[model samples]
Target chain A: AQSVTQLDSQVPVFEEAPVELRCNYSSSVSVYLFWYVQYPNQGLQLLLKYLSGSTLVKGINGFEAEFNKSQTSFHLRKPSVHISDTAEYFCAVSDYGSGNTGKLIFGQGTTLQVKP
Target chain B: DTAVSQTPKYLVTQMGNDKSIKCEQNLGHDTMYWYKQDSKKFLKIMFSYNNKELIINETVPNRFSPKSPDKAHLNLHINSLELGDSAVYFCASSQRTGNEKLFFGSGTQLSVL
Candidate 1:
């Protein structure tokens, strides 16, 4: 079984400040990583995904994440956040196998509250 | 145009009532899934269907049933609704091969009183 852990539930940061949301995963086999953002009462939208190739993956909305194989972590970071960036973020992982069904295992969401 | 659409975006019903939420995806994908988000905003996969064949069924209660008539439509029916069943249910779809990023619907917020 594969699972994802989002260490923080709520994070508060001032406008224009940098922030980071931590994510870690555990799987018996290789897996794919993705970040999704959810606005208030809205559906989840894909922020970015790490399939193969590079370790540093850039996503929409000025967000980026690093895929660290040694630590089994995919932490999301933003250089500067605005008030409009306040939203809930989720980290998900899917196994990399044929006929995987593409079912994603998601972590408890992390709410980013950007203050002015 | 809505890639994924779900009907009755907000549903409020009394306990013991039965309800159904319909979902349709126009992305021409062969796989669909249902996920539940609780009051605490924790997402859990309930079921998955690829080509209208059941592929993944989680440890969800039997009260919840998912039906897919074709590759583009998947619907969920619930029986004997309980207060614990109140949550936001999301419908998503993806291509069965190469590209696997899921496209999600706005969600149906079910409130069982």
Candidate 2:
């Protein structure tokens, strides 16, 4: 079975400050990782994804994540955030063993509150 | 035009009533899925269909049924709803199976009272 765990339930940071949201996963087989963002009263949007290649992946809105295979972790980071960055972030994983069903196991979302 | 869309953005119904949420994707994706988001913001996949064929059915109750009339349309029907059934239901689609990026609908918020 595959599972994802978000270390924080909520994170509060002042605007223009740096932020990191930690995510850890456990899977017996190879996996693909992704980050999604959801704004208030809106659907989720893909932030970035890690399928293969370099461990460091950059995403939209100046967001990036590093995939540490040994650590089994993919943490999202932003050097500076704006008030509009306040939203819910989710970490998800899909394992290759599922036979390409496109089924994703998501972690409990982390609410990012960008204080002004 | 919206890439993915679900009807009845907000649905409020009494317990024991039956309801259905309709979903369609204009992107012409071959796979569609239904996901549930609980109050705690935990998302779980309920059902998935590939080209109108059922591909994945999670450990969800039988009362929840999904139908895909075509490759671009997937609808979810719930019977005898309970208080626990009150959650936001999302419909998503991808270009194909296999770890592809998904486009999600705005979601249908179902409230059982």
Candidate 3:
């Protein structure tokens, strides 16, 4: 079974400050990693994903994440945050071996709070 | 235009009632999925379809069923809804294969009273 763990449940940051949301996963085979953002009362929006080729992946709204195979981690980061960046972020994984069903397993989620 | 859309953004019904949530995607993707977000904000995959064929059906109760008329549309029907059935259901779609990112609909907030 594949599972994702988001170390922090909530993160509070000041506007224009840098932030990082930690995510780690455990899976027997290869997997695809993703970050999704959910605004207030809205569905999840794909922020970015790591399939292969590069360790660092860039996403919308100046967000980026790096995949560390050895560490089994995919941590999202931003150099600076804005009030609009505040939202719930989820880390998900899909095992490459599950074929088409490879349903995504999401973490508990981290709520980003940006204060002005 | 919205890549994915679900009807009845908010659903409020009495217990033991039945309801259905409709979802349509115009992204021309061949894969669709249904997910449930509980009150605690834990997102769980309920079903998945590829080319209108069932691909994944989690351990969801028999009370929940999904229908996909075509590759672009996947609908969810709930039977004899209970208070525990209240949740936010999201419809998502992605390309058939290879590193694809899912596009999700606004979601249907079902509240069983």
Question: What is the interface root-mean-square deviation of candidate 2?
Answer: 0.8
The positional error of residue B79 in candidate 1, measured at the CA in angstroms, is: 1.0
- Candidate 2 chain B weakest ten by summed lDDT: B94-103
Model 1: fraction of native contacts: 0.65
Compute the lDDT for candidate 1.
0.94
Query: Compared with the real two-chain complex, what DockQ does model 3 have?
Result: 0.65
Of all native A–B interface contacts, model 2 reproduces a fraction of: 0.73
Candidate 1 clashes: the total is: 0
Location of the lowest summed lDDT over 10 successive residues in candidate 1 chain A: A95-104
Model 3 Cα lDDT, one tens digit per residue, B5-81: 99999999999999999999999999999999999899999998999999889999999999999999999999999
Give lDDT tens digits, candidate 1, residues B1-113: 99999988999999999999999999999899899999999999899888999988999999999999998999999999999999999999988833388899999999999
- After superposing candidate 2, which stretches have Cα over 4 Å from the reference? none
TM-score, chain A only, candidate 2, equals: 0.98
RMSD of each: 1.2, 0.7, 1.1
> Alpha-carbon error at B23 in model 1, in Å?
0.5
lDDT per residue for candidate 2 within B1-113, as digits (tens), equals: 99999999999999999999999999989999999999998999999998899999999999999999999999999999999999999999998877999899999999999
> Per-residue lDDT of A64-104 in model 2, one digit per residue for the tens?
99999999999999999999999999999998773768899
Task: Give a tens-digit lDDT track for model 3, residues A81-103.
Answer: 99999999999998777464658
Q: Model 3 reaches what TM-score against the true structure? A: 0.97
Cα-based lDDT for every prediction: 0.94, 0.95, 0.94
Clashing pairs in 1: none
